[model samples]
Target: MDLGPGRRAVPPRFVLPDVSEKNREGKRTARERLVVEREKQKAAERRRRALIVGASVVCVLALAAVVGVLAANSGKDKKSASDGPAVAPSGATGKDGLAIPVGKDTAKSSLTVWEDFRCPACKIFETTYRPTLHELVGAGKLKIDYHLVTIIDDGRGGSGSRQAANAAACAQDAGKFTAYHDVLYDNQPDETVDSFADDSKLIELAGKVDGLDTPAFRKCVKDGTHNSWVVKSNAAFDSGGFKGTPTVLFGGKNLAADPTMTPAKLKQMVEAANKG
Candidate 1:
């Protein structure tokens, strides 16, 4: 190009690069990295959820298995307790062989006592009248027919009464019923505590009686041999329509209901009956 009249030639100018386009490219790269990070976080969260669900399912299955096993054991125990014929104790007598005689059969007067081992009142009655009862029984003037019942077990929700009564029946089998019976009343626990529910505890108590804690006795107790018998006895008690335990009856009279009755009076009554 020619300039007019002494115009100098224009020099070429250098062009700068577009800075905004470079910034836009950098922004696109940052966005891509952010999207990748978000996808990775979502994938990790899904895996974590799946692991939690799997662990929960395993725990539920384990719990169900444990419950099933427990239910099966419980059913077996029930069947064992109620399925077979009730075997009466050795030398047990009375209707359905329910009574355990504590005195001679030839006694002139009979005292029928429905008792529960876990009964507090029965314990009191035994404690109060034991000496007189022993004297009369020794003299052969009066006989006692003990009808064991599980009234406490029925009412208070425990197996102590039934277990103890079964143990007493086991003692009867060993021909040590009278002595072991006395021992039980002597060391009876509180009615509220079902310590006697444990067969081991019952066996321990049997150790107090001489020659009572034999292998046979332990086996009888551990196996619950007379549990069915005890259940039948309790059923008999329910049918009798008599009141609570210590239902002592002499000559068709409820002696325990006689508020004025005493040990001496009981002796006199037995003597009178003998004379009659």
Candidate 2:
């Protein structure tokens, strides 16, 4: 370009770069990179939290399952303890070793007498025919197999029947069963009164019979050694479908049920069976 006349020619000035604008752009880029890095960090933290919560739920469920199993096993153990094994007494005979024999095995006439110590009617029958039965037993004309039962305890609400029966079995163990048996009937408590449920009471009753209140007998009664055997005998009675206590059967006849049956008639039947 030509300058005006009388004016000195001047060179054109160059524009300098704007350093403030470049600094602002650099700052904006840095801010964008920082934002991206923060988003990545947040995503990683969320994944970690989810993993922790899932693991906690699994642990809790496993703990509950273990607790449930242990509780079930504990309940089963308690049940097993209460309902233990059925153990028969020493020298028990008959089906399931239930009968307690009072007479000799060689006797030809055998009498099946299902009796309960707590039964009022049984006490009556015992008192009425005890002498004749004893006479026949002493003469070796008849044998009596006493099946001790707990029907009273089953029907009524008391453990007297079972407890007394267990005591009688203890007497059998001590070889004083006949003496103890008579004593039990002679001093039997009322059906409503469960005095015989006490082991001390049963032991005291054993004092009436000689050599029946020994330590072994007392231990047998207290420890309930024949409790399982008594239970088994009662179960047999139930399955036998017999009527009730004092079910005296001789020669296929329920002698106790016979309206005209007497002690004389029993003796006659036994003598006849023995002769035959």
Candidate 3:
């Protein structure tokens, strides 16, 4: 056991720590955490994209629903007589036998209405809602020029419109056009066969309305002198872009349909038109 001072016994052999299992486990845990974080980020991105797409789809559907609803409710209410432009009852027609109003003509308003005499809605417009517009006309707030279209061909084998036109023309000649106009609407038949074609019946109807020279009106109707005017009116109706009876022109604006054709809506449109 005696050793030199500078010499030292040989050191014992050192052994390395066995850490392979622990390192492997730690590596596995780190890899799993990384995978989990990546999965979470991917899921979040997918949810965000889905939300944006869903919102866009909902907006499109909402707009479509609104349009559909408006279309569905378009024809619900009939326009009242109080919702039209004005015209005076002055300025009578010729004294032959045609009826016309002779009054002081008013200033021109921006609204014009085109109508067919045989149209049911036109009759309703005259009888029910015309007074309001008449008052405006009388007050110089509205101007209504009646462009009479004959659509009787659609219903009465083409003769009804012709007869009515003849009668109207006669009324125009006698300066009783408006009076005769009212009479025709009052005596409108069921629009069926053999109803509006009878000449005798038309003569009888002529006899009922006052202010029309019976003899002249009868002769005018028999002679067909007023037929051309009716034909012209029908032709002009096409120029005005009318596709059917009861088509109305408001401030020169055309419409296939208006969901808001009532008095209130009409008033609004008129106001807007005036401003423009």
Q: Which candidate has the top score in lDDT?
A: 1
Mind giving the per-residue lDDT tens digits that candidate 1 earns over 1-276? 111111111111111112476676764554464355345435644565666777688878799888988777875784247556798999989999999998888999999988888776677577667888899999999899999988767655678989899999999999999888888888888766888898989899899999999999999998889989999988897788776667888878777667566677788889998899
Q: What is the lDDT of residue 34 in candidate 2?
A: 37
- How would you encode candidate 2's per-residue C-alpha lDDT over 74-101 as one tens digit per residue? 7453212224655566677887788888
Global Cα lDDT for candidate 1: 0.76
Backbone clashes in candidate 2 total: 0
Q: Model 3 TM-score?
A: 0.54
Return the TM-score for each candidate structure.
0.72, 0.70, 0.54
lDDT of each: 0.76, 0.73, 0.52
List clash counts for every candidate, in order: 0, 0, 27
In candidate 3, position 75 carries an lDDT of: 48
Q: After best superposition, candidate 2 residue 33: deviation in angstroms?
A: 99
- Candidate 3: tens digits of C-alpha lDDT, residues 1-276: 011111111111111122477576664554464355345435644565666777688879799888997678764522111123222123423222122332235444445455555554456455534555555556665555555555545333446666676667667667776567777778777544434455566777777667675787777676555555555556666675565555555655542145334444554554454455
Assess the local accuracy of residue 105 in candidate 3 as a C-alpha lDDT between 0 and 100: 52
> lDDT-based ranking, best first?
1, 2, 3
Whose TM-score is higher: candidate 1's or candidate 3's? 1
